[model samples]
Target chain A: MTKMTMVEALNLAMRQEMEKDDRVIILGEDVGVDGGVFRVTDSLISTFGEQRVVDTPLAESGIIGTSIGMAVYGLRPVCEIQFSGFSYYIFHQLEAHAARLRHRSQGRFHVPLVVRTPCGGGVRALEHHSESREAYYAHTPGVKMVIPSGPRNARALLVSAIRDPDPVVFFEPKALYRAFREEVPEEEESMPLGQPQLVREGDDVTIISYGAMMVPVLEAADSLKEKDGIVAEIIDLLTISPLDDTLIASSVQKTGRAVVVHEAPRSFGPGAELVARLVEKSFYYLEAPVKRVTGYDIVYPLFAREKAYMPDTGKIVQAVKETLEV
Target chain B: MPRSEIELPYRIEYLSILDENGNLDKELEPDIPDDILVKLHREMLSGRRFDERMLNLQRQGRIGTFPPIKGQEASQLGAVATLKNSDWMVPAFREALAEFWRGKPRENFILFYGGYDEGGAVEEGRNDLPVAIPVGSQMLHAVGIGMGIQYRRKDDVVMTFFGDGATSEGDFHEALNFAGVFQAPVIFICQNNQWAISVPRSRQTHAKTLAQKALAHGLPGIQVDGNDVLAVYAAAREAVERARTGKGPTLIECFTYRMSLHTTADDPKKYRSEDEVKEWEKRDPIPRFQAYLTQKGLLTDEVVEQLEADIAQEIQGAIDRAEKLMAREVDPLDMFNHTFAELPPSLILQRQEAELDLSLRKEEDRHD
Candidate 1:
């Protein structure tokens, strides 16, 4: 095991996958000689040559459209969008071709494609660089949307996304790219695509979150335990789509109260889906209404107002307490 | 101060081996086997017959709306004739004839227009991509497949087909740019049918020739008489050879006309004139090719009769088969299939809910 950040863990996953499978290829703008904008694919060009680590021309639709073609042609292509905001240019290709290719062809062809882009706020970056828009991909049918909170899960889930048969949109939390480090195993390890991991088991209320918000969620759980004498169950929802709901439903059933947290806007966000699922699966078991601490419906604010836009520890703690009140 | 004109590397060329009067430029004619020429003529004829039959079927409500491949048969079948079985054919919606020439069954097209998911199921080992309905989207896939072929050091090239209006799309430029940058062995065939639904080709782009659009991306570009089978075949053959030998990508714009509506649902009378349609009818590919083949002693009146009869029987057989397939009770649950390799738990629950809903509906229907 070695201590690595999320960026290093993701790079290691791509390296290991490429080494094991000759069909695996990495391509995007500046992904080759210049590594990547965020340096997530650093030093990969030297190891895999330009053929496998291709530096494509700067066009989002072209990168993804060509990647879909490569995947359909029996090559495992992992493409990168410079940022999550740039992903809008690729949504047409994603929705029309990548997401629908398998179902459109009735299993005649499938896209073994992985699209990795850094998302979420708190990096104090330029406009369009921040924002968590997992809802767009999660709402798309025949596409898998996965977000990893930390280094360990990021590495394992990225490997799983690479091996998945369908197209997978992997949103790497830009905030967590180097925020912390974890001891990631050097050997091959992969978590299932849709299974949520229970980081903490408690009885008072279930605190469910994913991606970069898990940092504040963890801090709030600790604060709730020490200050309020309330132990909160923590669930990290790695895969937003295909939400196994098994863990969330059972966790909510046990806790009888739940608080969901995310960095995306509150309206029609992943938090809404979690709350709806809880109401459906564990309605009778509920002690109080499920609360959500999420970003506002307005545009993701600039760095000056980033704090007020994101769901921090204080907001999560307050939401959890609100769920526990009744 | 006077500025000197910059000398460009490429000069776009126009090719026309056969004229509207069935006259061929003997020196420019490609040396093709007599049997293959006959096959090409037969396939073009079959494509025309298929279009006529499909139109009648749609009028009778036998199939859903589909784009008609009239007047563009030579552009499609002739270009596709240059492809070997090992090469790939990435197609947009209007390349049904090309797909048929590449070994896709006629019934598949019928099934697709009939709105069945099984229609898009390409058999294993065929390198053909399913017909992409979105305009210009399949071109990038062709470039990607070429990239894969280059990586494997294979000689097989990829040929993709799209319409003239697709040139306006960003994907069109992006696909051409990447193909040129990567030196991917891909032949882009733009069938300039002169119309994108209600919009005319002139409105699609300001460029004088769609073929010249490739020059901006550093690729060879050429224009051809799309109605002339000899011209399209020759250009496709040259492009295929160039790509096969790793000379990089080329763009061939076959200037054709939309003799029919853009689709079954479109009304050409609303936007186009009858005089223009008549002008293009004089240059229709089939009769021109037929007259040329007959003059060369390669075709006879008896052969024409025999070929038409064969095409009729084949299309009738396909229609009957599609009708039989359509008669079967469609499984509602089949919609949930093929979204993923394995159904996730969420999908499993949704499928179960659908199944239970169907069973409960059946019970209610029995009581009613």
Candidate 2:
């Protein structure tokens, strides 16, 4: 086991996968000599050389369009959009071509590509850098969405994303890139996508969350247990698209109360889907209405008000407490 | 050599190896064999007949709305002739002639506009992407395939065909920029057919010519007489060789004209004058090539008669086979299966629901 941050673990995952599969290629802006804007792909160029690790021009649409072609042509390409907010430029390729290639071709073609981008805000970034646009990708059919909370899951999920037969958008939480280090099994451990992880089990209230919000949710769960003597179960949703709906529904059924946390806007975020799934599957089991601790529906502010906009431990604990009382 | 002074005057030259009356510029003509010329002429005639048959089919309410490729055969066949079987082709909607010349089955092309998924069911070992309906998007896909070739260290070039209107899309610029920067082994063939539906070419751009647009993107752009197969073939061959030999991408603008409606749904007569159509009809690619073949003693009335008979019989047989197989149309259930490599439980349930709906409808029909 090697103790590494999320960035290091992800880089190691890509290196291992590329070493194992010659067909695996990396293409994006500054992923070569520049090592990506966050250095997540740092030192990868020297190890893999220029052929495998490519630095493309500043054209997101072209990056995705070409990646789709490469994937259809039988190469496993992991394309980076630099930032999740910038992924809008590539949505046409993703939604129209990449997602529908197999369907349109009647299984004659499949694009086994992984689109990676840094998402969510906690490090106080400027405009278009810290937005959570997972809903836009997950809402589209044929493509899978995988988001990781910390170092270990990031490594494992990215490995699975590359291995997946369909195109996957792997959203990395920039906030947690270096927030903490954990003993991530470098090459030994791999996690299955589309399944939720039981972070901490409890009975009173089940809290479902993903991406950067998992950090604050876990804190609130611990604080709720220690201060209020309220046991709150935390479920980290690793994959957002093919959601582990059964797990969330069953946990909500048992606990009879729930709180969904996310940094995405509350209106149509993954929280809305989780809440609807709970109500749809185990409506009578719920003891109270589902509570949501999420970011405001306004544009994510700069550093000064970043914490205020994002869901924090204080807000998550209060939401959980209210749900528990009901 | 990459660096050059801009002091000298530059002009975008047009190449025409064969004139309107089938007279070849002896110095510029390629040394094409008689058998190859016969084959080229036969394919162009077949393409013309196919276009005519599709137009009739649409009028009879048999096939779906279709774009007529009356005068663009040589423009397509000449550029696509240089591609090997191992190379990748990303074609747009109006590129049936190119695909057919590249050895894609006429049946596949028919099934596609016939509104079926199997139309795009390019079999194993074929690297041709399906005819993209959206304008200009496939250009980027071509660049991507080029990058893949670069990665594999293969000397294969990827080619994508688009119309003049597609150059106005953002994808076109991005694709050109990426291809130029990465030195991707891609050939961009812009079939400048004069009209983008109702929009005239002049209204589309302020530039004097479409070929000059590639210069801004740092690619060698050439203009060829699209009506002259020999001229198009020469320019395309040179561009394909440049890409395959690692000289990077080239943009070849095939200057041609659309002699039919944009599609079965369009009425060209409403937007353009009959005089314009009459002018282009005189420059049709088929007669121009036939004239050249007749001059070289390569094509005679006997060969023409036999070739026309063979093409008509072959097309009639393919149509009969396609029409008879109408019952084997792609099932709607195919939507759920290929969406993902493995259907998640939710999708499986959705498929079951769809199946259930089908059964219930069948049951109701039984009562009737």
- Each model's fraction of native contacts: 0.00, 0.00
Q: Tell me the DockQ of each model, to 2 decimals.
A: 0.02, 0.02
Cα lDDT tens digits, model 2, A138-171, are 8999999999999998999999999999999999
Candidate 1 Cα lDDT to native? 0.87
lDDT scores of the candidates, listed in order: 0.87, 0.83
Cα shift from native, residue B271, model 1 (Å): 1.3
lDDT tens readout by residue for model 1, A145-212: 99999999999999999999999999999988989999999999999999999999999999999999
Number of residue pairs clashing in candidate 1, backbone atoms closer than 3 angstroms, sequence gap of 3 or more or interchain: 0
Chain A TM-score for predicted structure 2: 0.98
Residue A280 in model 2: lDDT: 89
Off by over 4 Å in 1: A1-326
Given the true complex, what DockQ would model 1 score? Answer: 0.02
Clashing pairs in 2: none
Q: What residue pairs are clashing in model 1?
A: none
Q: Could you tell me every candidate's TM-score relative to the true structure?
A: 0.58, 0.56
What TM-score would chain B receive for each of the candidates shown? 0.98, 0.95
